[model samples]
Structures are given as C-alpha cells and as structure tokens.
Target: MTPHRPSQHARRLVAALLAGSGLALGGCHADRIVNEAYPTTYQQRHPIVLSEGAARLDLPVGGGAGGLTERQRQDIRAFAADWRKNGRGPVGMMIPDAAAGVHSSPAIRNTLAAAGVPSTQIVSRRYPVDGPETAVVKLGYVKLKANVPHPCGLWPEDLGHGGGDYYGASQNREYWNFGCATQANLAAQVADPEDLARPRAQSPVYAARRQTVIEKHRDGEDTTTNYRQEDVEVSEVGGK
Candidate 1:
C-alpha cells in the first residue's frame, strides 16, 4: 500500500539503486561467485617426449651395432602404428651403424607417415660411437600422467653382484630401466597401448653388461629424465 503511493519515476529510481547495489556486491565476490556458479573444465593432458626436439643420433658402431631382424622391423612398425593413434609418430630411431640395413631417420619418418603417423613426429639418427656395439633404437613420446608405476619391481637387486653398490655407487643398477618402464606404463595407460609398445627393448639387466658399464659411467648422479615420476609431490595445490 505504501509503495502504491509512489510515482512511477520514484519506483524506477529505487529499482535502479537496488540493481546498482546488487552489481557492486557481485563484483566484490566475482571470483568466488563465478567459481561456485559456473565451474570450468579443469583438465590435464598427459606428457609426451618429442623426437624432433630432444633426440640424439650417432654412428651405430662399437657398442651400438646390431642388425635389426625382419621381426624387429615389424615390431617397430607396429609400434609406430600405435603411436600414430595418439597424434604422434616415431621421432627417432637409433641404429648401430649408419651403413647397417637400418633405415635413415627420413626414411623412417616417411614410412611412419605412410602408416598414418603425422610427418612432424618422426626423427632418425645413427650412433657415431666406435666398436662391437649393440643395436639400440629409441622412440620418444609424452607421458599421460604425472606419476606412473614401474613394473620390474621397485628396487630389485642382482644377488650375484654386490648389493646397494652393484652399479657403482647407486643402490639400484636398474634405476633407469625401472624408471623407463614406469613412464612407459603410465604413457600406455594415458595414450593408446599400441604406441606404448613400439619403443620396447630388452630389459637393462638382460642387455649386455657393457651397456650397463656405460650407463654406470654416465650415471653422473642424476637418476632419471625430466619426465621421470617422483615418489613425493612438491605442490600443495592439487594435493600433489
């Protein structure tokens, strides 16, 4: 009844004041209000290692030499197929010798592209080292999650060798192997399983002891790649 006594102009003025007050309050609590009222899409993509950027190539001799069998080539092709599904392809292939039957990086790139992988993802390199080398082929890709579990059983020791110091000073001789396995498993889970299998190689322990020796000499205190997962989370935001 009391409002009925007010003129239309007065009513409009009061309404305008109320609207202005509401807007001011909303502005003060903007972030909270928006967060509560309209949640955004909070998503995280997995990590991948690009062959084009981080790969190294050398002559495949003296510790890098081993001929890839037809079966091995097929396996590599299969692996490439899987990676292509994840919008990636083989970034690099490390053959023992440049003259070996192994295809050059460009050839591998073309082959992968024909098989459906994007051309930008392929890389090829030959190891340059000298003498009785084992054949090593490296494939690179990003990981899907921040933490992935490794399969060779965490911290297993070779009883035949000294414990805790088998690989020189490090407690785990298979650290890099385990680390790679862990990353591979995580990548497999996040990406397609097929792509995860392409770069598969013999376990570090199974490989010739010479490679182990080289790895030990190169250990240099650093244990794993940047993509390697850690035991503890350093950030508090994601409860990580």
Candidate 2:
C-alpha cells in the first residue's frame, strides 16, 4: 500500500512556519492589531509634509532672535506653497520654550496666514524636547497610497506594507520613531511635482543614511512572533 500523505491541517502548519520565517527575514513587524481593525484607510494613505529650504519666521533660536531677511521670507513663502501642495497643510505649530514669547505675537500669525495657510490649522504647543525654538508648522496635502512596503505599521518603509504597533503596555512611552521621518524624506524628494512623476534611485549615501536611521529608530520590531509550537504540534499530529 502507498504511504498516507499528511493531512491538510499538517500542510497548513508547515506553510505558516515558512511564511513566518519569510516575514522575519524580510523584516515584517506585524502588530497585534489586525489590518481589518481600522475603520478607515485615512491613516493608511495620509501624506506627511516636510519642511524644505530654510525655516522662515525666526522667533528665537538658542537664546537670540532669528532674523529672516526679505529674500529669505520670499523663499519661505515659496517653500510653504510647495509643502501645501504635497503635504497636509497647516496642521499645527510647535514652539520651543525659548521662542515661546516671540512666536505668540500676533504679527507672526498674520504673516503666516497671509502666506496662504489658514490660521485655524495653526496649533501652537510647547516643544516636546529641548532643541532649537523651531516652528512645527502643519503643512497640507492629500494622502497618497504608499508606493513601497513597510515592515512594521509604525513606518511606511519603501518595502510596501503598512500597520501600527499596538501595545497596551507602552502606550504612554514616546514612540518618536515612526513614519514621520520617512514621510519627511519622501516629501523632500517629491517637493517638486516633476520629481514625483519621475522615478529615481537612492544614492549610496542616501541608502547608508536610511539604514542608519532605521537602525537608530528600531523600524522593524513589531512583527516578530513565535509560532514554533503550533508548527510542531501540526507536524507531530500529521507525522510530517
């Protein structure tokens, strides 16, 4: 008599093992939350704006006031337009503690609003960390599907996948390392609409820098899991 083949259940277990291995090697950081859980795809396709050129409207840096020349102001206005077209605009603003006094002035609001951004979207908040008294201006644009896949949901890496890290334990912990940096990089590259249409390759320097950033940010960690026991059980039951 011919030997009996392993049952379908056994096959499924083997497949799961292989798939999990592939995910690990490919850096798939799966979150506990399923993709179906999200009610809307808004988060999936959201576009983040990047600050390009020099920052305009210098309030204060370190301890001194930052001066914006007339030419620089023009450049900033132009850059703001670019950001508006590509990213979600005027979402909000951030002020470092040192620049709090100057940024709160009414003149700054009038200037920014006159430049084309709506005043409503400008949210002012204390800088989360100590650094330059930079403005966290909200830029605007429609969301676009990620052209590449990402490992963890936290970041939309060039790989192409998307998801988020759903952890109850560290909900309050600072997870600064997310898709923001990638979105910013992509924003810089696609600042010009023409560049968005034309495809380009990452330079060696860029690749190196990207790798460094990913490592520093711990970009891929969520998808890691252990299904070895399940696989073993299936194999034992099916004798395969």
Candidate 3:
C-alpha cells in the first residue's frame, strides 16, 4: 500500500502550531523558514467580577409641599419597597442643602418607615446643592454590581506582518488576543453577575393556591390551571 499522506486540516494545524512556537526557541519565537501565513482569527475573553457598590434613586423636586407631589409619593413608596426587598446594607438619605432641608423630609421618612424600612435602618446626610437647580434627595444603599478590571484597547506592541504577531496573521487563525475588548464589554454589561452565577432563593409558597390544590387532590379532581383564551377571528386566519 502507498504511504498515507497527512490531510489538509492536519497539515494546516501542524503548520500553525509550529508557527506559534518559534523555529529558533521551539516555544514562542524561534527562527524558522516556514511560510505558514493563514488568517489570524482567535479572540480573547475576559472574566466579570461582582462587588458591593452604592445604588441610588434620584427623586426630583415636585410641586407639592416638602417638594413632593402625589406622583412623587407613589414613586417614593415604590423606592422604599425595593429597598425593603433587596437591601443588604443600611439605606442612606442624601438631602441637598439648597432647599432648606427638603420641606417634606419628615413625611418622606414616615412613608419609607411604613414600607418596611424602619427608622433605625435609615441614615441621613446633607450635601451642597448645585446652582439654583431644584434640590434632589438621593436615596442610596449597597448593592451588587458587575465590573471589568482595566480598560480595553491597549496595544503597546506592534502587530505587523513580518515577525512576532505577524506570524499569527499569516496563519488563517485569529490573533492571540483578538476581540478581548468585546468580551470585556459584555462582562461589564451584566446587570447582576451574582444572579448569573447562582439562582436566587425561592420566596414563600402561595398558601391559597396550595390549599386549593390540596382540596382538589382530596376530591380526585385536576389541580392544574386552565386559563380562558379568546377565540381568534377566522377571517384573518388566511388570505383570500
């Protein structure tokens, strides 16, 4: 039988690996006479880190007394509810000093207290207001955020076609560290890296639903829900 020849893919992979390892050194950069230039195509990926940071909700000045209107009250209630639900650290109130101590700070505090955020858990601080702009009270607390270390797009070394990374370009494969910034940006965009890493704890079960299911099970009836749906108009089902 004739001697079998290595396939094209095998030949290319070997050439690329050899190019990756220099002919002179046998690892990275060694002197070699091989012309194995393929399109460089590999991308580098970065990891995301989760850290604790302050979360702030800006409350703009309203027309009502204390600088809050009915709409503002509703919004503050929602904010307080969120803080009560997810706060892992004490909440802080940052009042602007330009507005004579937020005319309605007391009432706002009361609303927050009623929404499960107790008085003891709240801290107050005052800062100088900017210009004559309406004062804004910033409600903030500690929350988890996704962060990427170091900014992207740093190319100190030359990526030429004659030596070093040039060899990578000759091979059809991607450069050693290509597309790293894209990966880093994607990691940074994650809203909750901790949530992505692990699932949240399940909330308490619905007592009413559980009881209804139990009763149905005892009576030998189906406990599964069958929601009603509107019938689609037959005329629009198909074109004439």
Candidate 4:
C-alpha cells in the first residue's frame, strides 16, 4: 500500500465549505441584533370604550290628563330630571297617534315641563298596534355609558391538551384574560365617561387649612399635618 494525501483542489473545496458555514452563522447573528421585544398584556392595550346610551321609556298611555295619578306624576318628574342632568342628546317625548287609541294629553306634557324639560323637544309618531286597545307612550333620550365590545373568558388553546404547554406560562407573561373583567367592571361603574377622557377642574383651595399651615410655618413649628383618625365600626363585615 502507498501513502496518499488530499490533493490541492480537494483542500480548497473543504475551505470553501467552512467559509460558507461561517457566513451563514454571521447572517443569523445579524438578524438577532435587532430582535427587541416587549410583551404587553391585553388588558393594558385594550381599554374600555364608551358610547352614548339611548333608550325609550314606555309610560302607560292612560297616564295623561286626569288619568295620571300622583305616583305616575312623581315617576315622570324623576325621569325628566335624570335625563336633563345626565342625558347626552336631546330628550324627546314621543306621543302615540290618536289612531293607536291613545292621544297625547295635558298631564304628560305638564309633568315633563315641570321637571325643567323644554316643550320644543316633544315629537309624535304612530305605529300599527294589532288591537284597538290603548298603547304606551314613549320618551327617548341618550345618556353616556362605558362598554367593552369584546367579552372576556375566551380560551384559544386547551390547558391540558399538550401537557401544560402554554405560551404565556412559558414566557412568564400574564394570560390574555387577566384583568379583563376588572377593567370592564370599572368601565360600567363610571358615572361619567368623559371623566375617563379628561380630568375635572381642580376644586377651590381650603382657606382654613391653608391658614393653619401658614401659622405653623411662621412659628417655626413642623408643617406636617396631624390627621384626625376616628374609630370605625367593622361589625357590618359579617352582617346580613
């Protein structure tokens, strides 16, 4: 047997293969240089949306003229007051047509007016009621409300389907449904949706408190406040 060695061309080919592999690895490193990421929770990104609330109030058709009782008048007053205070759009009083077997009466108009709702907003429309019986009157208005279009508690992947293989858990990230219900509840509880958009004007400064602080500072005494703490009863926690 005779000793044999790699030819020049063979050595050159091996070197080319090694250089190609190095170039491929360098390309991969370049891609990783700009791969910065920040995983954000769905709750933080998707806040509650608000809309103008609108609905019609169905008052008894007979609650007009002398037909309206004292209780009915009180309810109408309350409704009108609320609409005037919190309603977004024009508060309208819709009267049923005479052909509907009920006509707009003086009592209905008077009750709304007494509550400070203007008379110019009243309008009338008729719809075919199957029976000749009296129909209910409608008062419609729009109010502010907070809402979220997408509901919570959706699972795109099963938990135990692949032996606890979850992307959120693996990445130490919050689940998609986390804090969604809390956000929705907060939105519904908001009295005014506009408050969420902008802060209200600051209240006037407390003159008495300001004077006390000023006197203390002038006398070289500590300006820190001694807060009044009263004992609060906690019995209600276990009560009915």
Model 4 TM-score on a 0 to 1 scale: 0.69
Clashes of 2: 20
Predicted candidate 3 versus true structure: per-residue lDDT over 1-240, tens digit per residue: 999999999999999888766654652332233443332332223345677777777776546766677787887788877676666788899877765446657767887887788899999988887654667878888877666555666554357756566544654445535666666776667655677568999999999999999999999999999876686445756676
Tens digit of per-residue lDDT, candidate 1, span 76-100:
5676665654433345555545444
Global lDDT of each model?
0.48, 0.48, 0.70, 0.71
Model 2 lDDT tens row, 1-240: 999999999999999999999988555434433433332333344354223332333333232234343554564477556546644435344454545444443444555677776777676665453544344333223433233233335532232223253431234323333454565456546535445556677756767656666775686544333456654533367565
Error of 1 at 177 (Å): 24
**Native-to-model Cα distance after best TM-score fit, residue 173 in candidate 1, in Å:** 36
lDDT of 4 at 55: 58
Which candidate has the top score in TM-score? 4
Model 4 accuracy (lDDT, Cα): 0.71
Off by over 4 Å in 4: 1-39, 44-46, 63-65, 98-105, 132-134, 161-165, 220-240
- Counting clashing residue pairs in each candidate, in order, gives 28, 20, 20, 0
The TM-scores of all predictions, comma-separated, are 0.30, 0.30, 0.55, 0.69
